[model samples]
Target: MSSRLYILLLVLLIATGGCRRGTDAPGIPEYDFMPLEAGRYRIYDVQETQYARNTLPLQHSYRLKETVGPAYTDVSGHRAYRLLRYRQTSNSLSWQPDSIWSVRLVNNEVIRTENGRDFVSLLYPVSNGLRWNGNRYNLWQSEEYEARNVGQPFSVSGKEFGETVTVIASNDSTLIGQTKRVDIYAHQIGMIYKERTYLQFCTDTPACLGKNQIEYGIRQIYRIQTYGKE
Candidate 1:
């Protein structure tokens, strides 16, 4: 086991799947899908629906901004980026800090941490219809994510992207409730659109017999508004 041999093997690992980043090349494989750089930011329009039993559903709209602050080595010795999230409700309202999250690339997969929960966002060689467990790294129930509509053109907020990929995180529905989570990413841009729903409906009664009547739940959508480097 010589130093030269070890170094060679390490280089091969990196070239294969160690990290999605190398020397900032024009086309850096998966980097286009999950870009990780400092000072880059994106603004999104958010819509949420809340429901409660015996009450009308409440609709809320707001704006969210996510900025990549800086890169630092994490406990696992991998380079990670600090993600800062801001929220605003109205044009007159100033952006306020909402939360702090982190994103890192391990091997060939992208991991994003939110609220102390790790979720695998994407993997290398992103082929259409590829599936993987997004919660494999965390101590949670196994949740599968499938990549669809790869290398397709999409439009959002009057912006047209030549290439995009959609990840179906969850899709389940029953007579009583439904839970669906989806995210769309554009080439050179990050996540362009996101939608999630977790709703429970009425049951065992005439009014709630079909379970179509909502009892309580939450639905949310996020659409990209503006994005650029700072």
Candidate 2:
């Protein structure tokens, strides 16, 4: 080919590359729900409430800070990431050592092991209505977990995120009572919010079915207050 033609082809290639970098291009990478890396941490404000039949409800609020530490091998011989958790009660002014948790990515799912219980936190290729057994290895029997509102925008603590995912876990039947747990995660970030509601009632008692009857329940909520990396 002539030198002029070669120069023309080079210019066209550069133009194509520039176009791919534009905002309208589809070359951008997707967000990972669990971006486990050392030196990253997130802080959250936690609120816990407990309700029982014929008793006053009790509530407590606090702050929880979690930091990702070095990687280590778990009991199952899988590579896992270590998380150091710090807690600050309402009466305390400083954070203190809380507990240690382990997280691992296995079979395209993000699993977190806390207090000797394994929970499938997030599933790969997350999309709306995606469902799985988040508590398959837990003490809970026959719980169903689902993903919703994937890739949606969300805001927390005055910070905006381009994408977010919500995971819900509950039983299939509510004949006796209902127990639901929800976790919301922001893209590129970890959990931004979490809620759990558990209610139990006497099924065979007529007094328990009364409209004014008291039910035993507990609700806990966690919200992100601030997050950063070390």
Candidate 3:
């Protein structure tokens, strides 16, 4: 490569390095705060949206509960059992949850459950009290990077209530770089609604160029009444 070309490439590489705070790519933005905090309230949205996945619309419903101890309702959404509890903690402006079964977070490093079982960890975001994990890793970054890396940039066309952002990252060979879009909901800022969809996507499949759109909606009825003496 020519000396001039090499210098230009080096510059590009340096700029693209993940070392630059939040410089993942040309469009990712780094966030400026710790994501997890304590004393935060979160409203779980169950099933409030819909879309066609593989050309067929899917109708799925599930229930979840936040127990106070090492127990939770069973899969039937009717039976209760002794499983584990989740403890929420935080510092200046972030909330971290400690589960009763396995997994914990200390000094930024995440530790899995002591038992030899597969379990997911939960941590709250700095923007009040939103819970997320590695599966939703982009939540740790700014809106720009979060939208770019994990999902897609929030566009006006995708806006809804209070800037709803949806992202899907799949490794299926038949759908590489398939399709990603971010729905922005900036209107319903304070009023937490009953139903909302977090993610939606449609990608091509096989040589037939068949398209599929899958979406996960939360039709939940929860409240987020703030607590503590402010």
Highest-scoring model, lDDT:
1
Worst 10 residues of 3 by lDDT: 28-37
lDDT of 3 by residue, 43-154 (tens): 2223323444444445443322223223234343532223233323322333234344333334332223324332222222223223333343332432221222212233
- Give the per-residue lDDT of model 2 (tens digit) for 121-190: 8888788999988888876685678999899987777878788998887633365666768888998788
TM-score per prediction, in order, is 0.87, 0.78, 0.27
TM-score of 3: 0.27
Residue pair clashes in candidate 2: none
**Global lDDT for candidate 3?**
0.31
Best by TM-score: 1
Work out how many backbone clashes candidate 3 has.
29
Candidate scoring better on TM-score of 1 and 2: 1
Stretches of candidate 2 off by over 4 Å are: 1-29, 138-142, 171-175, 202-205, 210-213
**Whose lDDT is higher: candidate 1's or candidate 3's?**
1
Model 1: CA > 4 A from native: 1-27
Please report how far candidate 3 places residue 184 from its true position, in Å.
14
